[model samples]
Target: MADSDMGELAPSSSMDRRDPDLYIEDGNIVLSAKDNENNTVYFRVHKSTLVKNSPEAFGNMFSVPTPPNMDQYDGVPLVQMPDDAKSLRDFLTILYDPQCIATILKAEDFPKMLRPVELARKYQVDWICKLVASQLQSSWPDSLFQWNIVAREEGDIRAWDAYRTEAPEGDMDEPRGLRCLPEPVSSIILARQCDVPAILPVAFLHLLRFPSEIYDYNEVFPWQIPERSLLSQQDWARLVLARERITRWFTQEGPQPWKDCGTSGMQCQVITLTTWLNIAQEVAVDGNILKLYGRQVKGDICDKCKQKLEDRFYHLSVQFFRNLKHFFQLDE
Candidate 1:
């Protein structure tokens, strides 16, 4: 492709330009998207890559002969994309750079993933969707064991508290809390849009811990929270009901953790029970379990007794977490 293919960059008609690095001259096809100011940003990439990566959509699309008078850019077939240039750039980066898969898998690049995931689904890019979903599932928890593992990897989650403050006057800040975790609502929105059911249970559960004022969107935050109206009424009902059940369960049943304890000594049971009662009260008001779970109970007791209490607590946490889909009405 030549610069003249896009036309000489005239001051009056410079809305069309090639992506500096992505415009491969030897590429057989051109993918174009509109930038923020309505400029046309073009990416020249191999036709085989699109077919191989999106067999259901692009592959099927190109299976037929090119119709007469079809659009072209520098003799290459042009495909107009529905995606915006910024997101399309990220999507193309994932498509062109194989090494970037590992980058998106880490917790640090979590927020950068949403647009690509959304674009991948829109274009029926199955592999990218699966990879991003797997990364998301790992970021969340399926059991108390997994939760504790992520917690340790986070290394003193209080350090993330700087992400919270009065909402900025402009767009929300990046990397809000816990390894740039997407606000629960945003995750729920993406999960719903992309049909990633595995993420919904924990995403909904995470939302239960946030302050109710977040629904207003005017609340202070470092991360973006999409408007609550975007969520379906059914989801809202599920969230509300789930919150009630969580509060009830923690209050009525959560504190009595040592009942089946086999410990011969009563000291561990007494101390553990008292600690849980305090935790139960805090959960009633805030329901921020991740933060609460990290609190240290007195360790004066013998190791065996402490181990028994901890085992029982883990079991209960697991039991409750496994029911999140049910509580969120997603089990169906």
Candidate 2:
């Protein structure tokens, strides 16, 4: 009933130091930070827009009669929010404008997207949570090339090329012929947090490329990682162990020379074979056998062994991927 009895509230901070992009001059509600230095950080947003996206949460808020002598800034109702200003602003910004995160595949601000997910889940805003989750999920497909192929097969060729062409350009080296989440680690964190299972294998596979130190570090990650976004010990173990098993299997499969047909004297060169092995290992780590075969088929193999080797590699990879579910314990 009193401030002294309510215990310590979490400290408030802003997502942006300067004015947040969402601060409208004539808005209906004021989401004030819990701290005393109030207007230093706040959001001015329309009540109807918030209510539309989050009917249950906002409906309940408006249903209750206004309390006496409640704080109001410039005739707008001031609602105290325990969330830091930045997260609240980002969440409200998306609610006011649905397209805020639509075209951006890479995480311009991962936590900006993630905060909405946390808040959406907290407030039982399923649509808002699903919007953020889908945005996060779009970064990683079940199979990158397979994703394109499926799109094309489904008669959406335009979307296939658009997604392919939309690859984020920068110093980041993405998987060959595949689209990847801008920040795999952050996406993995979001996937687990939101219970978006379809994207987990891809996220975990991409994380294998990172060094072990990246997981638990306190410093800011490149993807704007939220504070203490560590995976459970079981998940970390599962990812690491899966990477090792996949790598080992591919390496062993790599060195074997292809079977010969007497008519054609085509043989893989030692260096070329090594490169093929490396590509196989990469594809296995990436969780796509078809991509591995696609890369291999592009090489200079003679006609006699081409189809045979392709069949062999396909069977091996499919078998491996089948076992992968067991390795990752996906069945459970």
Candidate 3:
């Protein structure tokens, strides 16, 4: 708890019992929300802690106004939150638990932090939003080499390894963020909603690597309602342009056989180039590039040629990403 003995809400609500998971036996305030199962979940917490974390959101609410019209159950004031019980629980976990943020930062699943982030923004809780944004911003690779690695490694890479994934675990300069969730398109939609702009470019790129089947049907995503309206017109346009640009890059000026190969035969270079070109073409058409390929190169090619190939690919990929950003008016 950030603050203690600061103030208290009305006590002992028979109608508002303490939540076993969130109740700090002697805490001052009780927060409650209805769960999906239609049960009221209560949280016993300190008003001071909430106030300290989000002054604009909670401070005024907790204060004694000129004429207080408070909501109470069984004599104890109850704060009604708009979020579902699960999201509220996760939001509180981030606020109170020291290890929760660390867990969120490292989790392979992006949805783990999605609900919490939504609640944070809904309530105008700036700190949590900023924390999430920071994690997301740090996840993007700054250098060409790093970007290349991320393009190949995709979701499994650390947010920062050499700012990509292979960097030492102890490195502190780059923290990671959640990878594309549901799919890259969904992840971009989530990012746009959350106001995290840095994630857009890479997310768009990842989305390009998939098939339209993932985005064409509204039922595929749980969010869309009666209308089939997931992506915006601009988003669809960006996807089309990105595909055209990448297709041209692959077919017209694809990776050439690197001359650095020594022990590995030229046949291996051909296979690797062919694979890379295929992925580019597939990505343009919304094909499953990931399913067709994995990170492992095995012993098929020599290390030097592989490095050269990746380096070359990195140059073209970065250029394509920049061009795509321009097409979407996201470069700014």
Top TM-score model: 1
Displacement of the residue 231 alpha carbon in candidate 3, Å: 6.3
Better of 1 and 3 by TM-score: 1
Q: 29-148, model 3: which lDDT tens digit per residue?
A: 678877777667788777877888777778878776523445654345567777788898888877788477776665424557677778777767776666666666566554445565
Task: Report the poorest 10 consecutive residues by lDDT, candidate 3.
Answer: 219-228
Worst 10 residues of 2 by lDDT: 217-226
lDDT, residue 24, candidate 3: 75
Task: Please give the TM-score that candidate 2 achieves against the real structure.
Answer: 0.61
Which portions of model 2 show Cα errors greater than 4 Å?
A: 1-25, 34-40, 105-112, 133-139, 143-182, 193-195, 210-234, 248-291, 294-310
What's the CA error at residue 83 for candidate 2, in Å?
0.7
lDDT against the true structure, per candidate, is 0.68, 0.58, 0.59
| lDDT for each residue of candidate 1 in 169-189, tens digit (9 for 90 to 100) | 544544433442455665676
Candidate 2 differs from the real structure by a C-alpha RMSD in angstroms, to one decimal, of 8.8
Model 1: how far residue 280 lies from native, Å: 4.4
